[model samples]
Target: MSSIARRAAAAAATGLTGAVALAVTLTGVPSALGATTGTASLGALRASTEVAVAAHGVNKEGYEGDEAPAGVDVHQEVSTAQLVEAADSVQDPAATGTSGTRTGIGCSGDGTSGNRVQAVYVGVAGQNDRYDAVVGALRAYTAGVDGVYLASAMEHGGRRQIRWVHDSSCQVVVDHVVLNPSDVASFGAERSALVAKGYDRGDRKYLLYTDAAVLCGVANVFTDTSPLQSNANNGGYAQYARVDAPCWAPQDHSVEAHELTHTLGAVLSFAPHATANGHCTDESDVMCYVDGSGVVMTQSCPTTHEKLLDCGGDDYFNTNPAPGSALATNWNAANSSFLFDPPAPTATLSYDGSAAVLAPSVPSGQGWRVDWTAPGCTPATATTTSPGGARLAVSCPSGGTVTATLTQQDGRTAQASTAASASGTPAPASSAAPTPTPGATANPGPSVAPTAPATTPVATLALGLTTVTPKTVAGTRVVLTGTATTGTAPAAGTRVALQRKQGTGWTTLGWARTSAQGTVSLTVAPVATTAYRLAAGTTTSAALTVTVTPKVQVSASGLTVKGAVRPAAKGTRVALVQHGRAVATTRTDAAGRFVLTAPRSGSGYAVTVAAQPIAQLALSAR
Candidate 1:
């Protein structure tokens, strides 16, 4: 039968919603046995005994709330009656298999009962006029296939029954659809609800098939083909199938057959049956390519159909197949061989100041061996049945590449590589000379021939300071100077600035640029006590301090001595001191008058005065 005809038939049988179900297996009661070593009474008693054992062992492990079993192995046989009885103990009678039934409505496949595949067909009730044709095509395609069964067309009851028939650990049911553009959101919501329920109940895997438009909208707003796009964009399972628009609806059944190939592809790609033997470019496999010519249906392709069922290059229906084919063929393919062995030990390699290097140990026993295919780097060798099971260690040689490869025993190899680059660190500051302090000079003599510009190779600019005696004159200013030379002659426009340290940061006070002779003189009014430094570009000169004293006067009344405020103003008050000792404390009566004995000439008498609070003034004399 042609693939299209078979698909159509399967669709018809399963109905519009594709709700067909499978039958559960049951075990029978055991016959009584005689005990020859016992007495005649004991033998009769034993002969009359009838022990009821489960036809099949049901593994409840890993089956949590609403979770289905991992897989059902039904190739082996036991009593159908016992299976039913066992199922009855765990499930309601309505969910149990009836006597002599080969296929139960809404039932799930059990590997033990020899049922491995369950098929369903999706179609719209009134809108899909081609439903019969589609179902007929599908049925003909799957004829005489072992472990495969077709679902009936009734929608609601069948879905519920399928869910109930399988134990929580083993069976999965996927809903398939071809959505119109307008129905995408509704379709997505339905799909999400199904997946959410599955996850809430502890089931990890789900299957879905939708049109390319829907899939593209769901997976990537920007890519061509994707499985995860449908599920993740729709917020559901990790995987899904997308049938290109040119294939299913409005097109021929050939496209439908191609989509069915995708259904088979998903099962082959995921857990319990995954293989590393295929690539997307492989024309011989349906899993490798999508079938169609840009939006238009043309001729049918047999190679396309053949690849879909090749089951990893082995002919369809082969009993003992290669791992690649086994994974690609059916959902129930055994995965025991896919297990990976422990990895080999690691070895340390040479180490540079910036990075450490290492090599991989050799794999001992074999199934598959790991190879560090990364150029100039090595990975630890290890045995594994699957890819990505070994470890690799490598340090990037300043701006280079590293690659890793895995070689299977069957000559099937896969490689992955990455690139590396170098990074730089900042230089540290100098510790030889002290940091230049604000307003200070490093030298103290009349400037000799000023050195060349600080940028010159021979002469570096340095600061010098000179004292300024306080005079009775107002507006007196002190000048600070620095010297510099440029190779043969100093460059002009050499600028310098002064900065004062305040709190945690520096505040700019004044600036001066040097002339062609490389000398700078800064003038400033001396304050009480201040520290400042001179800066030239990235370098600075040392720090210095200056002091200023106010004029003093004293008067006396008997032994008590008082000092008149030197400045004599509304803001100043006077206190008396004699022989360096304060004799009395008094404030001027707005006349700046305080009484005190006049000290002899050059006597180092001291006096104190408090200034008005509003002016922030205080004075001392010695």
Candidate 2:
């Protein structure tokens, strides 16, 4: 009957959805809840109000927030549909399902059967311009993925590369959505508006936000975003990707990639209870666990949410096969959203009597390292060369475990376990002389590596850049050729790119994959002195410096010296030489022509190009 009571009734009737201060309750209530209950049950009413918001799941374990009975660890529940991808049906028991689409993204006709093109539509919490940045960052982040795939190739032989099947550009689309809210939608009521607005259905949405103390991601699909995902069971619904605003703008790309990985597909065993410690085994990987210490962990979570664990520096594309790991299975689908994906690269680790060999079965740009720990000996690490072949000897008669791991240039690594044997029998005869480790004492006993397989191996890449002629005139087309090798044999079909050095940076002018003989050539015109090199994976050719010289045209206006610099660039100095002695000097103008002020007869005339500014600095300073 009272005015305040009447107003509350009207607000409640409208299905309250706003902020906590605005929620008519407190903090964050259901986007649909008003704070007014005007009674003692305001706590109970507010509790129910917060449940009405349409975001995603919120953490409640050890969570002392306004919700969850204050100050106790209650395990939070999340739905399977809300994770980056609902994998309940697509689980890769072998962790080898080309990520989200190992069998091929279901397509039709000229299409691969059972495959479909997948797209990710990015949405913000609200429509405000402030949220536009989230969409922009998402696009920028996804663009770098293609390059990462190529550059980080682990050399899985036989079409392991995630070569796209479509000539059309989109494996995944990164753009803003008109139907989704642009503000923080960590509650159910808000995201419900997105569904009503008619967004791309099927949990393929990525929402950007500013909230820091809530759910960063969920493991399944859900119907609502109430705290702890209580209504997640029947939500068989549109789950999405969400991260704090700072996460999108962070200094590292790992966070974005990490978040995207969740949406693509995460390992089911990666939860706290699964002994995975909320991450994959590799500490250096982008998907490593972030612990309570803020230290990125190299180990699994013994208990759930005890510490904050997420991806770390070692978290890069895990193309290395992970027998049963979900990360490997989901990598392709997560990266491209194409139902079709390529297999992770493959390699073999074996030992002759003395040396351990890690040989690539495919062409990979990535390097590898194997740690050899004999039955009772200290572990020693040996790394592969650029094109990637690593051979290190373990002490004989002490067979041990050989763990092969993908190695990073930054010295980080992933976790893997495999077996290695070095002994209990006589060493084999040496096929070739042992390559000595610097400062290592030669073993008294002769050691032989395993016999070479029928096929020669790809080696550490060695590249060379050369022109038919080292010197040439400006504008003259010159034939440039490059040679590449794995140091042991000619590297065939490896990607070789041409680059020109400018200042401290190198720009790619063009690229040609290598021929069977490991050669790449192209024709180029040099207008000025330029240095060029060839890059193959992590190896670069020696710099080929080409010196371009220009011929000048000289004439006379009765001793008034005149000349044109062939390149037509100014600063050439023309001298009037009388019997090989300079009688007058002048510099060329913008048109590259120079003229003397008065007449002076000369036996001969010559024009000299000005020294480069950098080389003339000392002379000018004097």
- On residues 411-522, what C-alpha lDDT tens digit does candidate 2 reach at each position? 3343333344433232222211222211111111122333322122334678988877889765566788888887668888666666677668664444466799988886
Task: Write candidate 1's Cα lDDT for 190-223 as tens digits.
Answer: 3344334331111111222232222211110111
Stretches of candidate 1 off by over 4 Å are: 1-461, 468-475, 485-491, 501-505, 551-575, 586-605, 608-622
TM-score of each predicted structure versus truth: 0.21, 0.30
lDDT top scorer? 2
Every model: Cα RMSD to truth: 37.7, 20.0
Error of 1 at 190 (Å): 90
**Candidate 2 error regions (>4 Å):** 1-379, 382-402, 407-466, 474-477, 483-491, 494-512, 523-545, 550-603, 610-622
Q: What is the lDDT of residue 393 in candidate 2?
A: 47
**Strongest candidate by TM-score:** 2
